[model samples]
Structure formats: C-alpha cells, structure tokens
Target: MLYRKKRYRINDYVFIGDNCHIGNNAFISSSVKIWNNKRIENNDKITQCNL
Candidate 1:
C-alpha cells in the first residue's frame, strides 16, 4: 500500500510481509501500531517471515 502524507489515528496496525518493499516518502503515523504479526526468521542475514 502507498500513501502521500496520510494521517492515522491511534491503535492502527501496520503489517509488512516478507520481501515487502516500502516505497520512499512513506508516512507512517506515530499513533499507528506496527504489530508485525509475521516473525522474522533467524538466518545469516534475515530469515524473518516479514521484512
């Protein structure tokens, strides 16, 4: 998902999946809650399910 200067209220959940690429100029509001349900795996680099 992409947005331009978007505002979010409190208790917002942002989920980024594996290999997910967040474009530039992405504004994630401070009030938003990033749960990150997907766990990152343990690897030499990063094996987590989510980026």
Candidate 2:
C-alpha cells in the first residue's frame, strides 16, 4: 500500500500476508496490534509504529 502521511489504525488485530509492501510516510498507531507469522516489508520512510 502507498501511504503518504496517512494513518493506518488497527483496533483489534492485524494479520498481513507474505510479500506485503508498505510505502513511505505510513503511520501505524500504538494501539494497533500485529499478529505473528506475518510478513511486512517497509521500503522507505517509516513514520510511526510501536512495532
């Protein structure tokens, strides 16, 4: 996904598949929870994410 100063908020849980791509200026809040066994590839410009 392409995020330019955009925020992605996960209330309950988040499950990402393999070869997932996250673009620049992405914001994942601290309340968000990421599950195990998921793959996340951040190309560049990571903004906010507790994990």
Candidate 3:
C-alpha cells in the first residue's frame, strides 16, 4: 500500500519513467494515462466493481 508520484493524474502531457509498480486494489481513472516505465500487478478479487 504505497502510492505517491504526485497522485498519478499525469495526462495532457504525460511522463512516467521509473521502476514502477501499481497493484493491490487498482483503478486508475481520469482518462487513464501512461508515458514510460511500467509495472502493474493487480491481484483481482472483485465481486462488484462498477466505476
């Protein structure tokens, strides 16, 4: 449970570069944006996720 990177609302001029890891109850919103550097592991276990 660790996420900071400026609240991750990067878009309109995206830029993400580093050893990133995004997982554990994941739901990246606001049009979804990604620039560089990648690592996303979401252990799915949802019965109802409507958003």
Per-candidate Cα RMSD to the true structure, in Å, reads 12.6, 10.3, 12.0
Residue pairs in candidate 2 whose N, alpha carbon or C atoms collide under 3 angstroms:
none
> Model 3, poorest ten-residue lDDT window?
6-15
- TM-score each candidate: 0.27, 0.27, 0.26
Compute the lDDT for candidate 1: 0.36
Candidate 1: 10-residue stretch with minimal lDDT: 40-49
* Candidate 1 clashes between residue pairs 3 or more apart in a chain or in different chains: 40-48, 41-47, 41-48
Ranking, lDDT, top scorer first: 3, 2, 1
- Lowest-lDDT window of 10 residues in candidate 2? 42-51
Error of 1 at 2 (Å): 26
Going through the candidates in the order shown, the clash numbers are 3, 0, 0
Q: Alpha carbon lDDT of residue 17, candidate 2? A: 41
Q: Which lDDT tens digits does candidate 1 get at residues 5-24?
A: 62322224544444533333
* TM-score, structure 3 vs. true: 0.26
Off by over 4 Å in 1: 1-11, 28-51
Question: On residues 13-35, what C-alpha lDDT tens digit does candidate 2 reach at each position?
Answer: 44444455544444344344344
